[model samples]
Target chain A: MRAGERAYQALRADIVEWRLLPGQVLGEVELSERLGISRTPVREALSRLTADGLTEPHSGRGVVVATISAEDVRSLYEFRDSLDCRAAELAARRGDPEVFRALAGELLEALEGLTSDDDPDHASYYELVQRMDAAIDEAAANPFLRQAQTGVRLHLARVRKLSKSDPRRLASAAVEHQRIAQAIADGDPALAIATTRVHLSNALQHALNTKELAPVRPAAS
Target chain B: MRAGERAYQALRADIVEWRLLPGQVLGEVELSERLGISRTPVREALSRLTADGLTEPHSGRGVVVATISAEDVRSLYEFRDSLDCRAAELAARRGDPEVFRALAGELLEALEGLTSDDDPDHASYYELVQRMDAAIDEAAANPFLRQAQTGVRLHLARVRKLSKSDPRRLASAAVEHQRIAQAIADGDPALAIATTRVHLSNALQHALNTKELAPVRPAAS
Candidate 1:
């Protein structure tokens, strides 16, 4: 891989995984030295990260990871409500039925393992949701929409860390995914849109409630 | 303005205005010389344009302007239907009533001048549409949604050149904008979404027809 791309992927993974917390300063020289690369590639990667809204310029501290407030979460889901619903509708209209059918079956199977107390199952369920998202984007066959959806999902990934421990939310989300998959498999655009709306609304509520009870940042090291 | 920003604005204007035709190779040295800037800034500008989907990397040709097919127009409108509707709905809920009321009045006045033979009026009508778009985005007040909408509008600008000569289309579009503005002014989300849907459907039809009739490119200069 190209050095810039490698740096981008590494930095992006760190940010998304919350290994690099929000508001953490990312000095280009420090990152270049730590990653064993030249400053050029690190600078390029930081520019891309800023473009992706993952980081922002600080007056004197270089770039810092962007923080997600409750308001940001609310706005993110509101935007997702439009994007996910449209994606599901388009996927139903243009997607391969067999692909969605297989996905529906997989989602159903995944739901069976999603108990309220199983942490591993919740992790796997999130993975299944990501797969479903990819399948829907593929089925939709619109590059522009996919690009927009991808941008929103990047932030959604970061926000997911704020609510990942809720088992009940995981279980309900699994059922919601099943409904969306089945609707797409059946080639029902309206049903797919409706189900997606429900899923996004439920997910937003859970994110908001979880955010209310949890601290947004880790204890200072 | 910064050199990169200058290059970006100049190149973007060329693309949107069709001076830089789709599929035309964008040689870095040539553009830098023409724009009177260094290759570094021109390169950065091209990179930004690529991110905007206005250009793409070719196998042997470096980067060339991206082409829009009939299918691309279809897909663009399908995505716009979702975006414009959501933006209008949000604007209705959150926007300033007086702003839209004034915009609606302006649209109504523009409609009066949009006769089939008056080309200048048509240009002004399109500008009004752009202002209304900006106002609605401002009212929606979500930076993420605005960003997504702005990306889509970048391509939409290129597509507009494909169908700008149709006076009847312009007149009807003016009326449609008036309705959307009025709905937002009245704080009716449902009405705003409904009018936006109508406008997008009409726009898609017009673009598809225009693509069918117009040659995708001009003969060699």
Candidate 2:
């Protein structure tokens, strides 16, 4: 991969992981030195970030990490609720049963470990989600739908990052995934969609609660 | 607004309305003269278009107006269905009842004026959708949802422009809006979402069918 591409990927990961929290200054010279790249590649990476909505362009000079408000979370769920339901519906109808079965097995294995964990943070389930996302992508049957999912998923990542660690919630979420996978395996499109919607609504409500309890973002300086 | 802004707006409108078909070359000099602007503003406008995903950068110079493919259409709808549903749900839960009632009134008025020979074509209906969207925006209390709606609506413009023109479809659509408005007005969140989903599914199916029937892009020269 090119130097610019590497910087872009690294910066994206940092943003998604909340390591570069909202409104963090992204000085080109500092980032170039940190990533061992020249200012040119860092500049290109920032441009890409601006395009992705992860960074806001400064007054013709630099960029800052984008901010997310409570309103952003609400809106993100609204998009997620609708898109996930439709994706589940299509996945149930179009996805390969064998692939779903394999995903279910993997998900079940992950859940088995998480269920025993007294405290499982977002990191524990990250890989499991990638598997689920791959399954959803394959089942969606429409490239446009997949692209839309990408945008929603980005927003969801922020929401998930702030959510409090709750074993009960993790268990319930895993169960919900199992139900959705079962519905897909059965070719029950309506059931799959409905199950997915319920799961998302509950998750969204949990996220909202987490936001309420967490310290509010200090107003932008 | 500068000349470049004017050119961008005019070109965007033309493209959205299918007045300028896909693969149209956007020559900077010609567009500059047409909009009474210098090439600098035109170039700036093109840069913005590249960011907006409405135009693609060329290998050497200039840009191509965006053209949608079957794949693009499907992906667009997947995202749109999710965003629209979320809009409907939020509109029901948080939007003012009066807003929905007013939307109902406008839709009915439009319905009353409809004539068998006066079917609303894609362009006209596209304008009409703006009114419907205004209602959704007013109802959705979140800015993120609103911004997401804008993205989905723009992409939907292409698929919508391709849908077959039938008085029946228009009348049916108006009726769907009436039901959706009623659900929102009544504070029936589930009903509002369900009705909106039905409306979108029908519209998407219609659009997909029309797109499939439309002649394939003439063999790229």
Candidate 3:
């Protein structure tokens, strides 16, 4: 990979996975030293991060990693509640029942595997959830709403990654996804909305209670 | 922040609010003199404003405030629907029944006063709506949603201000607000969502069809 691209990916991963925390100053000098890259590449990386909204300009201090505050999580989920519920409702109205029916089945099977197996790999489960999201977005069919979903989901991924991986959440989310998929497949917008809201509230609580957020933002980092 | 950013924010707000009209020249020396700052900071401010889409570079001159067109209105309203509907639904679910019920009552009474009187003062009616907004924000209890509202409403206020005032919207909005407040007061989230959606769409149509939006964003003003 190009030096800039390599630096950008490393910095982005560090930030996303919480090794590089919110409000941590991304000084070009320190980053170049730490990443073993030149300042030009580091600058490029920082610029990319800023564009991603993962970092922001600090007064005279250069750029600092953008925060996903407790309030931000709550606010994001609140926004997600709006976006996801509408998507689910539209899915119920216009989605292919078979597509959602299949997702519902996969979600149930994923839940069983998630709860019973010792395997910690959740990639498949998460992928299944993404598929369901894609299905819902496709069903929603409104270009405007779809565009909003894309933006919301991007923020959500960043926020969600800050959480300590709890196996418990994966199991609960499996059940929630199953219910939402089933509701959509059943062509029940109200039910889909109810299920989606329940999931969002639970997710918000999970995000708020995440160990990473418990201390709130780091004071001196 | 720095003098540059402060200048940028002030200039941006003035443009957004139309205090600085589109096509208005933003000469660095003039702004610096007005803001009691140096030209460098003013230049920095103008450059940042250009990047932010709040202003644009003029040939052989400095930046000027950006213009709004029909496309801008459409885009803003589309985004608003997603936000407002979610806020209304959340208010219905979490708001105190008495508060929204009282808002509903006030709206009805305001409608009577508004239509019955020859008086043109809409301050009372607008204040009532703002009170409802505050009540809804409080009930929703999501700081994130509330914050989003603050920004979006700023944009909305700016957009609405540019419009030629029509008396018809007030009477129509009163009925809509009453329905929405009553729905929330009755703890009917779906009804609140439906009513909020209806209001946004109607508002969008009114904004689009209004002649003010067409000729207001003048070229070479």
**Which has the greatest DockQ?**
1
Alpha-carbon deviation at A221 in model 2, angstroms? 7.3
> In model 3, where do residues sit more than 4 Å from their true spots?
A1-10, A32-75, A96-102, A105-119, A142-155, A162-172, A201-212, A215-221, B1-79, B89-139, B150-164, B178-198, B208-221
Better of 1 and 2 by DockQ: 1
Give all TM-scores, in the order shown: 0.91, 0.77, 0.64
Q: Is candidate 1 or candidate 2 better by lDDT?
A: 1
| Order of candidate numbers by lDDT, starting with the best | 1, 3, 2
Whole-model lDDT values for every prediction: 0.84, 0.75, 0.80
DockQ of each: 0.74, 0.44, 0.27
The candidate maximizing TM-score is: 1
Give residue A147's error in model 1 in angstroms.
0.8
lDDT of 3 by residue, B1-221 (tens): 67877987898788777788777888888889999999877876776566445677888587777677777777667667777887888889989999998999999899988887666768888899999999999998876566556656765776787766677887898899999999999999999999998998888888777636656654454
Provide the lDDT at B148 for model 2.
64
Clashes of each: 0, 4, 0
Output the lDDT of residue A32, model 1: 94
Candidate 3 per-residue lDDT over residues A123-145, each given as its tens digit: 88888889888899999876546
CAPRI band for model 1: medium
